[model samples]
Target chain A: MKFSRKTLGIPYGVFLTLFVVAPMIVLFYYAFTNGQGVFTLRNLTDFFTDPNTLGTLFYSLAIALTTTVVCLLIAYPVAYILATSKLKAKSVIIMIFVTPMWINFSLRITALKEILTLIEGNLAYYPFLNSVLGMTYDFLPFMILPIYNTIVKLDHSLTEAARDLGANERGAFLKVTVPLSLPGVVSGISMVFLPAMTNYVVLDMLYNSTYIMGSLIGSYFAAYNWHGGSMIALVLLGIICVFTLLTDSGEDDARTGGALL
Target chain B: MKKFRRILVPVLVLLFLYVPILMLALYSFTDSTQIGAIRSFTFKNYETLFTTDELRSMIVGTLLLALGSAVLATLLGTLGAVGAFYSKKRTSSIMSTVNQIPVINADVVTGFSLCILLVVVFGIPKDTYIPLVIGHVTLCAPFVYLSVIPKLKQMDPALYEAALDLGAKPRTALMKVVIPQILSGMVTGFMLAITLSLDDYFIATYTKPATFDTISTYVVNATKGSQTDIKTALWALSTLIFVLVIVLVLVMNLNSKKREQKEAKA
Candidate 1:
């Protein structure tokens, strides 16, 4: 008996339907309905109107934006150095930066919390700083890996050609290398930005704070307020969708280079 | 000065990355109740880590789940990639986009929504491992798909056709020819899935059985409570995990490097 190639996808299709598609539908349903299960736009209106929710949303955005910028600033130069260097063991160095990810993140954060306590008397005082530091520490490798992969695969001759045309090293890098590596930079931004927005773990472990979107949804669910949690999740999903669309373009090449494990 | 700056910048960044892990490693050896203050040096933490039933069970459970879900995720992910690679353009595109939803979505949202769908709506009990395993597979399968798709794209399309033309059944061709070409990808995907499952906190928090705790969930709860022995023991656990990871990554890198050299020679 012949099995069509398309039929091989049947299990995955069913899995996606049951898990991915159904959960989303359920989220939308819960977001739109109240405890009585009657459909209402109150959740939406409440999200926009409630100052607490709105504050948390804006605060989470600010944190995510700050974390993304810091990660990029720190990661770009490191990625650039590692990728462009003639050192034979650069792969080992890159592994050093990335292997930290393998240690359980909670443990890493706990370790960070300890170091911070040593540096500063109480962590509660420097919540924002610690949060940013924790995030930058955790997500920097992600930013580094993509940018390194992209820069490593970059056309070296383009920069050399720019140099041949009388462009200085800085000019050549700015014009050739920078432009070509934008896909990596953009992907790194998306990778860091989206997760930073929702990774309340960093905040929670570092400072016991719960003002972010992730903890907000978690709190709602913990309190049995699925409606509010779903609403926040829907809003977060919308933000991620828009961010992804804006950043979407030729990521296949950048992604194909890195092993990511 | 310029060369020195490049070296210095990377060195400092690497230092920043390693400081926390180094601190954990250092503390694991000391008989300190907290991270900062160090007293006498001892191996009590390691002893506690190995001996405690709670810690042992949690560690074992987490590893078992990671391996189990990774196997399931690899299967689904490989099938999806293979199927999509061979299917019509529209079908493949749809499959890719659907797969991306879970990948791009936040974990908190995925966990909450899955909890609602399976536990609340579908009437699956929270205590059962069904929700937890399904949640992990859902979390991981998309990544597997991503990793495997590249291998499918890299494989020569003619090879599968050639096998079929040689009178091999489609199943046999896929199993014998196509599968071998993509096995490396499947292995990478499996490893990735395991790490992701091990690292996950939010999804497990929502979908896991009431009594069960993965390392992430356990650490979070344990740190909140005042069990100094368990808390200090976790530092030892962290050191052990860090060492294990270093060894695994070094071995994998060396193996890959060897493979590349062999390919070059060939």
Candidate 2:
């Protein structure tokens, strides 16, 4: 039907105002108002000075980068397989991988914790490794689905063109399909990297609050260190906000990173 | 010979993904008080898990929370998506980003922020389902929105045109035309929302206490502090989860095959 824009505009505005703008305003209020609205930068300043907090910051970046690289290595091969193989039950393979997506994240983390604890009851060695692996497993479906979607959308005719012009299989596949799917890679990387960097609970549960970003903030909250927690929150949010903004700018064609959200 | 590479690719990929998960599934069966006791298999853990009321309730509670959060989030998110579908570019961007923030923002940050906001700012009671549901809905909304938008975008405007041309009212056109086109998006979104709510122990911890011990929380506690029986109980739970996941995968695959066949017919 021929509806006017006003019909949709008001409802949409109310949704955004309540959910998006209002919460952020509350966030900023809590960030600045240390029990009495003096509007100070104390939280931001304290975040930089604290060594333990800073250490966790470094750990988060290191873990996120490592997680992204490992996920790429693992997911690339899988995407390549789903792209190339003419298997009749390719949908079955997709279902198998996506099945993990359906399993509760907490359960998966708990399961990983079980296996790791079984392997080494002690903490100090590889909880970080386990955490990284857990994040990878949890987010792998996110990584694979987008890249696979890109591959499916790719023009196989390019490979035919490359092969006709005398390039070998490796050269054709790489030179053709891989480069063209960079948009998917961009989408996939941001998709995996953002949450992986931010998520610390998997580490917390598995490593018993080993002080990654997720756990660090969690610990502060548990301790009622609202100022300290918000301090860390500001820093983490600052690091991620640029990413949030980049993605917010409507990179619609770049990647559908919301494969499973 | 080159086709060998194509054949081998899938096998290798499957091994990479499944090997660790399989190892996890296996360890769920073997005894774990000897923590890494790989050889000894027993049904003792299963007996204990099945017998425990706390464990059973945690399972049920977690499922209920997951189902509630997913369903509610999808409902709201679907509303937001439909609303956004008719909004201007700028407004839609803001809404989608807002929808997205919960998913991308760190669980800790969101959890911490939400707890403070709910208790300190909004003056809500501490550790209630209200807070937990709000926190989860914030996270789950984007997932639903994300899943729905692509299908919504891909949907042909022609159907809406036809419905309207047939003199259907706006609501009727949406119900008859737009809704059917994006139903898969809604389904996928629902599935994703449920999955996320299930995985979320972090926010739940901040908002809800041990009174809300989920499977993840239960498993976490079970692993610590020289607790052999608890650990055995955890192993049983893990095996159950693994088997359940395998069955789910099979069902999903079958569903997808049917969809593909129906699409082929269409």
lDDT of 1 at B242: 90
**Candidate 2 lDDT, B1-266, residue by residue in tens:** 76787668657656655555566667656665543455677677777787878878888988998899888877777777877877788878877766666666777677777777776677777556788887777777777777788887999878888988999988888888888888887887888777777777667777775477877666666555577777667666766777887887677667767888999999
Give lDDT tens digits, candidate 1, residues B1-266.
99998999999998898888888899899989866785889999999999999999999999999999999999999998988888899988999989988887999999999999999899899787999999999999988998889889899999999999999998899999999999988988898899899999999999999899999999988878888999999999999999999999989889989999999999
After superposition, the stretches of candidate 1 with alpha carbons farther than 4 Å from their true spots are: A208-210, A251-259
The sequence of per-residue lDDT tens digits that candidate 2 reaches over residues A170-214 is: 999888988988766667787788788767666666664556776
Q: Pick the candidate with the highest lDDT.
A: 1
* A1-261: candidate 1 lDDT, tens digit per residue: 368988898899889989999999999999999999999999999999999999999889989999999999999999998999999998888888888877888988888888888898898897888899999988888889898888988988899999999999999999899989888899888778988999998898887575999989999988989898899999999998899889997544344334365
Worst 10 residues of 2 chain B by lDDT: B30-39
List residue ranges in candidate 2 displaced over 4 A. Answer: A1-16, A110-123, A126-131, A168-170, A205-210, A244-261, B1-16, B27-42, B88-90, B154-173
User: What's the true lDDT of residue B169 in model 1?
Assistant: 93
